[model samples]
Target: MNEKVSSSIPEAEAVIDTTPDNGQEGRIIMPEAERARISKESKKEEAWYSGEPFSSWEEVEVAVNEGLLVPVADSDHYKVSANAVEGGRYLTPVAKKMLDLVAGEWSKKMKKKGEDIDSLFLIVTSMTRIVSYQDGLSKKGFPTADSSNPRKSTHLRGGTFDLAFKWLKENRSVAYKILLEVLRDLHKKEQINLIEETTIGVLHVCVNPDKAKRRSSSRRLAGTGSAKR
Candidate 1:
């Protein structure tokens, strides 16, 4: 584990208001074609991880206990928002690894640039959510993918999380740019899917679960072969 960074960044400087407001006045609506593509790909990922969405907090707890889901806490590379994600900060083991990889890469890049890595960290505004919580967001008229079908939500699958951009840009402009660069590199590598939700002012990220599964299988096979020696 890396050295934990101090959470001294002012709340006002790190928090973003994600609450719904008036109609989509200045919000950037995703194109219908692009939206459909993201949904289709995300649905495939959901199926790969869990066949169904977590229906309640109890389900989440069961997944955690079964080692299917892991708790995501504030780390040196990132901070979990206290207000935005009310459901719970949890993610699949593979998703947590992906998040840490991205954050670690960002830290290395910042260090190479002679930047103060201690003062720079990504802010995760959202994580896993129960079906009921998804329903509440839908009732509030928030833009959610397949709100009517909670199982289609990637967040419920526990492989998706939102990174705050508005607050980062407003407070730490330089760190914001570097973080984008890191995400772009990872996106190009097909290690993750990145969705810039301008409407909500956050970057929605979904880790590639299929690839992780393949890697896990490969490791298991190798271990078994070595054991047979």
Candidate 2:
């Protein structure tokens, strides 16, 4: 197949081999082993900072602090905001740690993709924060659409941040692999959950509290949606 750009040959190439197989007379087959190796190596060599062997967000922060990580926003970009996305506001000490880690991962990932890491924007949601269950709702089933409560409010009671994936897609394809990679990473940590609302296009992640409290009397009545609930 043709390459996506005029760069290196993509591993998905179907090269025509003319080497005659001594055992098969006139029959010839492509080097399947070599092809498979290329495919495997490409994944190991994928261009994303987080995919790097030893990279982390701390390293990326050095670059950010040195007046880097500031690139122009695309016309379609809508991630910039006053609170979380712009000034990095309302972040607790613990939330900052997770933000650092997340930023480092994004930095390395962008480096791998041969993309500029400086240009990405952050939102308050990027910081992991506490999500408040509705005053009376639980996880088993959320309040019906007709219920008095339409949306459960989230706050940074201690630590947790929601990340805006929609912001990343402003100028890029919504299906960009990097965004999905970050999402899966957070999900694995069990520190984050994808929001149920399609319109939000964000990830909800929070730091695990050292000493968390649970209100069972109110929690069990409603199915617990959060890990602590």
Candidate 3:
């Protein structure tokens, strides 16, 4: 690890670690102090774009199925219940279907390692739209809001949601890794142009499954990139 040896506990700026990508450096950097400041401001920024206060977050366990978790169509109230997405807006019909595909794909993989694939949740780690509207898009446990959208706030339009594993033992579910591979594979076969996402190895992936993959194999065949967004 290329330790920069900052004099003190510098601020939390965007860091460019030269490790994960085979010694390749990160594309961004932030001073330690700037990081803390941004983090403080991130409280209200919205989860999808930037800040997410972990302290204020509450983690709860929920179930996942091999189908869409939220509802589609328009309604005065959220199509999905507050339980599914968690403390945010409701899940779009598209988002629900995506959640199911991920949960199922991950579960099947995790089961091999004795992981509780079913004990997953539609985490709302940031970008809290509203209570009743939340379909489990948590406003918790994110570093800082730095996207065009930001975290802890609503309006994370497009079919996106934060997902993660809860009671796993010994090792993190390899299912997460599998999920990425499947996604890349789908990108090849289906040409599903899933863009502007963090390849940050999240325990869960927030994506639009309908156009992305199917629930059956979680290995939705990748299409061509001809439909690049």
Clash count per candidate: 0, 28, 63
Question: After TM-score superposition, what is the CA distance of residue 162 in candidate 1 from its true location, in Å?
Answer: 1.2
Candidate 2 stretches with Cα past 4 Å from truth are 1-80, 83-88, 125-156, 174-176, 210-229
Best-performing candidate as measured by TM-score = 1
Model 3, 1-229: lDDT tens digits are 1122221111101121111343324233334565455445433222222222222212111101333123233122112322333433334344555555544555465556564433232222222233223323222222333422233332233234443222111123354455555545644454232222232222322342334433212221111111223
The TM-score measured for candidate 1 stands at 0.76
Q: How much is 156 displaced in model 3, in angstroms? A: 2.2
- For model 3, the stretches where C-alpha displacement exceeds 4 angstroms are 1-89, 110-155, 165-170, 186-229
What range of 10 consecutive residues in model 1 has the weakest lDDT sum? 220-229
Q: Write the residue-wise lDDT of candidate 2 on 1-229 in tens digits.
A: 1112221112101111112334754433334453343234222111111111112334334433543222222122123233333322333343445556565666566567676434343343333112233222223222111223212222213233555544345444422356567656765554443332223344444443221232112221112333432
TM-score of each: 0.76, 0.41, 0.36
Error of 2 at 176 (Å): 5.1
Q: Write the per-residue lDDT of candidate 1 for residues 1-229, one digit (tens) a residue.
A: 2243444546633457676434775343445665555455454344444446678888888777777778999898888876655556988788889889888988888788666766567778888888788887666545566635655677876878888888667656666788899888877776677777765668888776555553323221112211100
Work out candidate 2's RMSD over C-alphas: 19.9
Off by over 4 Å in 1: 1-15, 20-50, 84-87, 147-150, 213-229
